[model samples]
Target: MIEKNHIVGKEAQKAYLIGVANRNTPYEKAKEYIEELAFLAETADIRTIRSYIQNLDRPNRATYIGSGKLIEIRTKAEEEGVSVLIFDDELSPMQLRNIEKETNLAVLDRSALILHIFDLHAQTAQARLQVELAQNQYMLPRLTRLWTHLERQRGGTGTRGGAGEKEIETDRRIIRDRIALLKKELEKITRQDEERRKNRGEFVRIALIGYTNVGKSTLMNALTKSDVLVENKLFATLDTTVRKMVIDFTPFLISDTVGFIRKLPHHLVECFKSTLAEAKESDIILHVVDVSHPQFLDQIKVVQDTLKDLKIENKREIIIFNKIDALSADERETLETAWLSKEDAPALFISALKRENIEGFRNMVVDTVRAKHAEKFPNQKLELYS
Candidate 1:
């Protein structure tokens, strides 16, 4: 539902963000969501003019926000000359249409915004196919919003249907067909990927899993010595990148997969499951975390929940609390002590950007990979670096 052409050129599209705070989501949390939503807009190259949050018991079914609040927003947007309204939560087709009609501006929800980001980042054929499938699925139900320009034909004198109705039906069929074709193409690519993995010859596989913008790509680059695209944006690395490395003669494959985010669309998870197969098949998962974030713990839960949903929660994980350079000495010590006391999983605190504790990080990986490599190749003798 979000168009990118306006985002191009010198003047980026200006947008106002909307969020709802309810009994479940307090004002503070809703404010955080709005901030994240603004960041999402920024990543999509949209300039966030301002943000609005309504305190409601629940979101309005028709317009998402209260009528008064929406009116206020409309007036403010007009004063600011913002042409786009981005919602923190995904809206139903009816709600989206209502809000667009009432405000007379471009409307986008969290799901549509994330999908557009994925569409922009998708590079590999498989990644493109996966993103296309998710976009089609998301667009299928929201097709009515696309046909708002066409007037509905009256069924008075033997008319089949309105142009809008007929066009919607035709578009739905085309999207459905496109979805099916994308699925088939993805399955073929999945098979090819599986074959490639099988040919890797029993190397111990380690995959990096984490929340979006948590420095997973930077860490991957640090470890593998490969120049994978690293951007300071959410969902920067959509396609999985795997490289073979030898640490003290114990060779293994390490992969960097797409990062997890809060409120990620269900259709996206389903479509990208194939892309996440590397993590599913890995022997060890390096769950990277940005310790600098205020809600770092919540981000951990989000990743854990996503892993559980993917049925890979049982994998061996090492929680790497990254970006320690952003924390003070006292803060880092406090967090490390508290987290290590939990004794849930092996945790390491380091800064991938600053090359902090890098030797320790390498030693830990070498030890883990050596153990898994021993299991795979019992007859081979590998040297460990300490």
Candidate 2:
């Protein structure tokens, strides 16, 4: 329900990101979320001017921060000419309304920010439909904030006091209708896509997944030699791209799907279920992590939990620690030592951008795929290939 003229324009907004830390969520966790929020804002063409974190045992329940902190933030925002305030967590509709009213500025929460990024990144018709469904659902609950009050026309001063409310109701009905349509459309698309996957001739499918901007697409391209839209920005590739790949005379399919992040909106996850069906149906899951990121372990936990939620936990997995090129010599040794010593799924490090240590990745994938191939197609001759 963002205003078209203001939000969907070329002018990049100056935004202040705020996060609240409680005893349950320490300052470090809130700080990590704020950093991710800034990335989300950048994806939506917003420039974050600064970030503010308040250590409250709980949110203010009205402002999401204390009144004094809100006042301090307002003064700082005015001095910096910040146009909007982005919160690290989702705010209630009342909280959204109250904050905007007090600060006299627009407000976006982490969920809204992620949805906006998805809105920007969705390319194909299916992706667009999925994103629209999520957006409409998010808007439906916040209609009051979306449609502001307007008393009457200048010429007809006493014409209406509740016209704004009526308009909001009308908009809500329209959005609800649109959401219904979008659901049906997506179901049809999902069925069609399912048929296509079924007819793809029983190829081994590998799904690449990781936190956003951590070289998942780079690994996909490097492994399959296919062009995927890769960028340094968050959620750069929203639509799934599947490519047929061959290693050691055994052919399989690989897909690059949307990257995961901390605190992804639950509604978005539901809306993108059809898009994630590829991963759920895959034979192998490549959980790529950026070992270079300071909080890579936290990011890894987030992705693992997401996979479990998606019920993709049973797939044979490979933990790929990517972007060794960004690490110092000492850091690389330390990561390899730590990961290599662990008794878990096979772990390997590579700089996909630099094509480093990729041969090892291929050999493992080849072995994994070959084992599956042998188990499934034992009668098929592979003496020449192996």
Candidate 3:
């Protein structure tokens, strides 16, 4: 099992972040990637001591970085007393083994770090089961890495296999069995959740979606007056939270699902498919953005790409540019003008934390939800704001 603290004795584990830039990814973009990776490490309670970016045509096949660069990183990490090496991209199984062997330190890729954070933040039974399923699926293919401590004996003419091989096989079997079991359990829970959704029939459903730590939970609290966990950390909300809200005599169901990030683990997405179903079934998608961030546009692209992956990109979307209080008056006005001109979707600028323009935000939601409700259930009689 992965530990949430990832601490050594009484000290928090220090990490060294590594990234590689090729033609597809230039140096500046790679720097932003490293920054995000550092944030992920911070979310996992790991301290980042240093970061290294290697400009290469392609990643090294064996170690993901050149041998000389790896050696340099190892020396600096040892000097800094770093306990872990975190990579910005998902590492192959062979690369993981070779890197660990070369560095003689604990190694983790972006996916594994996100998985650890999810493991830490999971509160409900469904979330726990989903995290466990993702962890098991991620571990199944890396069994050899997990059993590296065991010695692999030379095969004899009469022998079946070595103890390490045997142990790995056994572990793989167990994980596969566990994965099947988890799927069935999740299916059962999903059915129950489906029934609940059905029970809330005729209520307009809206899902809050955005990059991690983009104030989606804060926005949820402002819109629904329900206290969802509002945190500055990544993957803070792993379970889906639903609340009923009435605005101007119009009632609807709103949900806050787990936030998305670049390079999110496919296994995690597969495991949490049921939790994200709220968004898939929503009549309106509230795609939130942190207008204050330097890379808010890239974050929007990441969110949209994720929605495409989930096949929910066709749903009606309302881009809520949040955290406008952090921006200057001119900057906010410029951004609002540019986005509103696009007319791609209904874009609104507001600060959920400061409650700025929240009434305007509410009015927009009511209008959109009422429109969707009437489109879906034209004959239903509900006194809505004209």
Candidate 4:
């Protein structure tokens, strides 16, 4: 098996991204997805030498795309000197194996790409351990041909003859054992987290959650004046950060955690359960949306679905539509009209990047938190001068 140190050098490989869509997926939407995938590949430091799109009713069972398309991609990859192939969708293990056989290039899907980014972004020991656990769980099922080409080229005395084969088998067993041990470590951490949260008492907790690259980190910096690693890349913040903020002498806890994405892997959700508990235990959730994105509505649905999956749907929330400065006049008119027509849930518009309407956004949050606090602690009275 290739050592962990070797994975970094392999990142130098050039990549070609492929996206497939069907009748259910509109052409425009598919194009947007492909563009996003290219950006994601770039963020992972992979040079995109080429890309392909295939319109089909659905993926082929054996190879995802048709074999003919696969052959075309392989030929193009060979001509372009591409060393990696990335898909826009998660592939079944069988499909992954089939594609690897056809392409002769290292293959990865969107989930894998996201995991890789998380692996790189994880900073804290807890975050690192959580990411490693998730990666191990994901790697377990696909270990059969793990770095097969690398092994062949390395050709050490390690894998020569029956002894070599036996050694490989032993290494696989050790990986499996490590997976179990890491899982146990995560369980211990989860328990400790629960206890710590329980001991924090009755302070109102608010969580900022939204789709990746929507300026959640920027908003956090704006609110708390705390420096967090903010970037224009996906999965920039993988670990949870909690800060105490006071609004008009009212103290509340606000947390910024990993942002959600469309089709975020199920395994990741399961693995990041403790990190996400910040949202779960919150008294209010600030669902940040990039108002400037043409598909911001669709992103809202994705975040809502993810929250529902995490069983935090009934929590009180405020819709903070950010990046208002990035919208044009006509687009702003249309979005304002659309937003004004929505009912029930409270909403505010602001430009986190430009600090536009931020004071108004802060007031809205304070009002919501105060209302929730009053309800939760009936004996305490909160006064507002405005």
Candidate 5:
């Protein structure tokens, strides 16, 4: 029996982060990706003792890294007493098995790490059920090997009369049943959301979408003055919150939902489909990007891909470049030049933390929403100035 304390003990959990990229990736970019993996490990409550990055022509089929690198990782892990090895990329099941066999430590990929964080941050019943369903779906494929490993670790006498033997089967059955129940609950919730949307009538709806920890919650609070939870951690807000406000006496609804991350697990997207429906149903999208981050462009692409996956690509969107207060003058100048050079998308730069250019943001959103509304409902004819 694995005690709850075993899972939660800070002293017992030490992690080592690893990142690998092919010759196509620049060394600097690879390093940044590795640092992100470390941030993710920290958010999941795993202590990252070290990080390793390697450039290879291609990942090895068996272990994802070269044999020598694997051996080096094993030696370092043993020396540091690392409990978990976290990879920046998703590993194939065979690669996972190979790494575990070599290192004799718990192994997790970027997807699994994010799921674990979601599991920890989930608070509401809906959010918890969604996370649990996602976790089970992710675990189902690895169950056989995981159970075999568990059996090897926990050798016992026959005094319990095969209770341990049946535990894995019992757990699988429970998880399957729970998954079905959660699906039904989510269906009901979806129907309720549909009705709520219908009742919302002509009010314009906007949603804040962004990379995790890029200050979406802070922007939401600034825009609406609602005290949604704001934190420096990833996945801080799991449940979606919608607030209504009047900008220049024009009523509109804005929603704040869970943030996105690079390579966010497919299971999470599947499970949180209902929550993400808020974005799908919105009239406008406030796509926030952390302007200060070196990987800001990549972050933007991830959010765009996620939005496209959610089938909200056709919706009106304004790129809100956030965290300008943290950017150096040269960096700010570079970003401004980049934005000016781009002619396709509408973009705004602001510091949500300092409340700089918030009024400008609000005005831009109001004007955009009004234009979209007029375009949609030509007969109703709402003027922007009025």
Candidate 6:
């Protein structure tokens, strides 16, 4: 159990972040990737004490990083009092076991870290079920490596073919059964949700899709004047929240769905497929980007690739470069010049937090919704400004 206090310790939740740079991935990009990983750790209340990068064509099969580098990291972790080690990439089962044996500290890969955050952020029963399913699926394969923790709990590892192994097998079966039950429960929940969506009766669905913590919820609140929980932490909103939003006296539906991240676990995505249907079913995608982030372009690509993976590449979209209030003068100007020139999908710059250009955003959304509405319901007359 990598508890928050375990991470924060008595004073701070210290951790070491590790990454790999290969022929395709340069050191500079790897550094940025580790910085994002550190941010994620901080979101989980862990402070990154250091960052390590191993420039290998591929990860070391046994340890992920070389044995010599592992020793250096272990020594450094001891010196720095870092309690946890976080890898930027997912570690194989063998790699995880080897690294834990070598370091003798809590090691978490990107998937586990993200799942932990999701577990923390899950509130509603549906969200809880979704996260539990993801966790169980993740745990099923990693159960073998948890013997040490089980032994620590029982105060002994027991004899060969003994209690630890039996307990692990038992836990795996329980997790498998629980995963099955959760899937059924999610099926029920999703049926109810789909019925609810269907009850809305052909409403033009516009969904806010973006990278995590990039003002999607804030923008949703700004647009709908309804608070749906906005936080700075990643994966703050786990449930798909839908609200009836009317602009220009034309009623439509808007969904603030779960945000995307780089290397989001396949298991989690599989679990949340129903939750993600809000985006897949949308008529317009308000692709929000945090223009303030230095790697905003990369974030955009991540969201795009995720959408492509979901096979939802044909939806009409509007680029919403949010948080412009935090951008530097030169960055803001260049972004505007570059994006504003594009004629395919309209791109608008605004700050959801600062409420800058919100009215313009409203007008743009109303116009877009009107156009979509006209296309869907050519004979219907919208009660505009009545």
Writing each residue's lDDT as its tens digit, candidate 3 over 165-265 gives: 77679877988999999889999999999998888868889999999999999999988888899998999999899998888888889999999999999
lDDT, candidate 6, equals 0.85
**Angstrom error at residue 144, model 5:** 4.6
Structural RMSD, model 3: 4.6
Model 2 Cα lDDT, one tens digit per residue, 306-338: 888888878888899999999999989988888
- Output the lDDT of residue 84, model 3: 84
When 3 and 6 are scored with lDDT, the better candidate is: 3
Ten contiguous residues minimizing lDDT sum, candidate 5: 1-10
The parts of candidate 4 lying over 4 Å away from their true place are 1-11, 149-172, 381-386
Least lDDT summed over 10 consecutive residues: which range in candidate 2? 146-155
**What's the count of clashing pairs in each model shown?**
0, 0, 0, 0, 0, 3
Q: Model 5 clash tally?
A: 0
- State the displacement of the C-alpha of residue 140, model 4, in Å, after optimal TM-score superposition: 1.2
The runs of at least 3 residues in candidate 1 whose Cα sits more than 4 Å from the true structure, single-residue gaps closed, are: 1-10, 146-163, 383-386
lDDT of 4 by residue, 15-100 (tens): 88888877888777888888888878777787887778888889899998899999988898888888788899998889988998
Model 6, 1-386: lDDT tens per residue? 22323234456568899999998889999999998898889888888888999999999999999999999999999998886889999999889889988988778899988988887788899888898898788878887644445334334434423436677788778878988898899999999988987888767889999999999999999889888989988988898899986766878889998899999999999889888988888999999999888899899999999999888779998999999999888988988988778656679999998999999999998888888988998777777534
Model 3 alpha-carbon drift over 4 Å, by segment: 6-9, 146-163, 384-386
Q: Candidate 3: worst 10 consecutive residues by lDDT?
A: 149-158
TM-score of each: 0.92, 0.92, 0.93, 0.92, 0.89, 0.92
Q: Model 1 over residues 254-349: C-alpha lDDT tens digits?
A: 999999999999999999998899999999999999999999989999999999999996677999999999999999989988988977789999
lDDT of 1 at 145: 48
Clashing pairs in 1: none
lDDT of 5 by residue, 1-386 (tens): 22122333645478888887767767787888888888877776778888888878887899988879989989988898887888888888788878887887778888878877887788887888788788778776555444344344345343333345376577678768877887888788778888987888677789999999999999999988899999989899999999988777576789999999888898899899888888888889999999888888899999999888878878888899999999888988888887879757888989999999999998998788778777766676454435
Top-down lDDT ranking: 3, 1, 6, 2, 4, 5
Better of 1 and 5 by TM-score: 1
- Model 3, position 209, has a per-residue lDDT of 95
As for model 5, its CA RMSD to the true structure in angstroms is: 3.5
In Å, residue 10's CA in model 6 sits off its true spot by 7.3
